[model samples]
Target: MNNTDHTTATVEPAIRLESVTKQYVGAETVTALADVDLPVYGGEFLAIVGPSGSGKSTMLNLLGLLDGPTEGVVRLGGRDVTDLSETELTDARREYIGFVFQDFHLLPTLTAVENVTLPTAFTDGQYADRAVDLLGRVGLGDRLDHTPDELSGGQKQRVAIARALINRPEILLADEPTGNLDRETGVTILEEVRRICERGVAVVAVTHDELVTEYADRTVRLVDGRLGEGDDGFAT
Candidate 1:
């Protein structure tokens, strides 16, 4: 590679894994990730594809700060956060990372706006206005008062996207974001996510569906706890 290109490539990423490995110790020990190095940049959407038991969830957990690697470094905004205290980690998670789940995870009783504002309870700032603004951005402005049960699957996922952005997170970690939706709805949700990535949030989604990769700027596959280049248009 040219030196200038290499230099530009060194720009700090939103989140990175440096030789990360994860293990679970039970009656038998299982290794889930092995020496994986990945750097996901701002304004980029990355798709992680894998089969069952392939450690895709483990990688997502480490990136979301819900769990730490058994070995190696996880950098957020170019800083090593592997050794932060639980309280510090919580603070970092609140300030820097956002998450979306397959099941839409919205509290049943909260209205759309209320659900979007849920993350505000953990931090100091007020975000009621911001939450409404986000709902609008996700095209949910008219549905602000609706509860999860009152919304369609696509609308519910839209609300979840709004909720993930309420805190103005730097990176969004989505696990099977479109897993529950029908094909048409899933594509719509993927488009929404792509738009968000275009606006400069790093997005990392672990998905089983090959269609999801169509919206990703790049894709990588995980197999038996190892990482390698994935499809431009992905395959199982």
Candidate 2:
């Protein structure tokens, strides 16, 4: 069995945000995220639930190292990376993090397999072989040659999910991953995410879908850029 197939209790958190806050400065300085503390562990599916303008995107950006916090520390594999340079942060993102966005960002011109292998372009095709395996794992074995335009909504999302795992990242950050799918399709995609979490990849999903929260190992609500109440029990 692969190392990612089982969750190990001894593993440290994949990412941790301690008293993290994000502020945008312009005509008026605005705080996007307040002092938020979140720790994401391997094999965990954590849903960050909130309405629009409630800081979900801000938190996802901070967790994915796409943006630095105004204050506090962001740690990846327990190492403080809050002050890393842009180049260092870029390298860290490529090595340690995977991302899936709301829109199936598959290249319209690329085949499913090609889209899955896109991440390899940055690493000299080191993980190119895994593309086929990932596509099969996501139940798209027969759609390998299909382009995004030829696939169903769920199938296209499956391609995106497989692409996210091509790097074998320690953490997967999904922002409104199911926003474009129907209810049934969304459920199918969320189930795939649950399976990935079971395989020991920490999954942090920013979403407004209550149904998505039901699949999470734990759910934390955000309101007015701060952590709110409504602690759903962790997955057993």
Candidate 3:
């Protein structure tokens, strides 16, 4: 097996957040996440559930390392990441994390395969080939030449999922990934995500739909910027 495979095998939790807080300075000010602590183990599927303005998206952004915490620390594979320099953090994000958004975020002009292999821009040789294999696995082999506009919503989302898998990320952070799909399409996407988790990639998703929760092995609820207990959608 490759060294990357070996490394992932040895890791404990893929992601861990300790007393994380995020604040926004819009209009006046707002606290999005308040001292939230979470741990996501490798090879597990986790769901973050809440209503609008419940800090679900904020937590996903934090997990993706797209935004830094206003307080506390975030650790990936047991290493603290909050204090890294911007460049270091950027490198870490590229090497360790993958993201899928509700919008599918594909370039309008790029072919589906090109979109899936976009990570090659930051990575090198072998990973580029790996991206191609990922696209095939997502059942997009015949749609490789099609652009986002030419594909159906489900197809586009499949390409996005393959793109997220290109980096071989230990943790997959998806934010409302099925929000734009119809019920049947949403279930298809969730099943694909569940397949990824079954292959040992940790999948962390933030979703409000109750149907989606059935795919998660564990569900953590957030409310008013705080972590809550059980399924009532309130953070303690």
Better of 1 and 2 by lDDT: 1
Q: Give the TM-score of candidate 1.
A: 0.93
lDDT of candidate 1 over 4-101, digit per residue (tens)? 23646666888999999999989999999999999998899999997888899999999999999999999998889999999999999988899999
Return the candidate ranking by TM-score, descending: 1, 2, 3
Clashes by residue pair, model 3: 227-235, 227-236, 228-234, 228-235, 228-236
Query: In terms of TM-score, which candidate is strongest?
Result: 1
lDDT (10s digit) by residue, model 3, range 49-142 = 9878988888998888888999999988878888888899888888878899889999998988788888777556776567668778888888
After superposition, the stretches of candidate 3 with alpha carbons farther than 4 Å from their true spots are 1-11, 122-128, 232-236
Question: Regarding TM-score, does 1 or 3 come out ahead?
Answer: 1
Q: How close is candidate 2 to the true structure, as a TM-score?
A: 0.91
- The superposed Cα distance between candidate 1 and the true structure at residue 135, in angstroms, equals 0.9
The per-candidate count of clashes, in order, stands at 0, 0, 5
lDDT of 1 at 61: 95
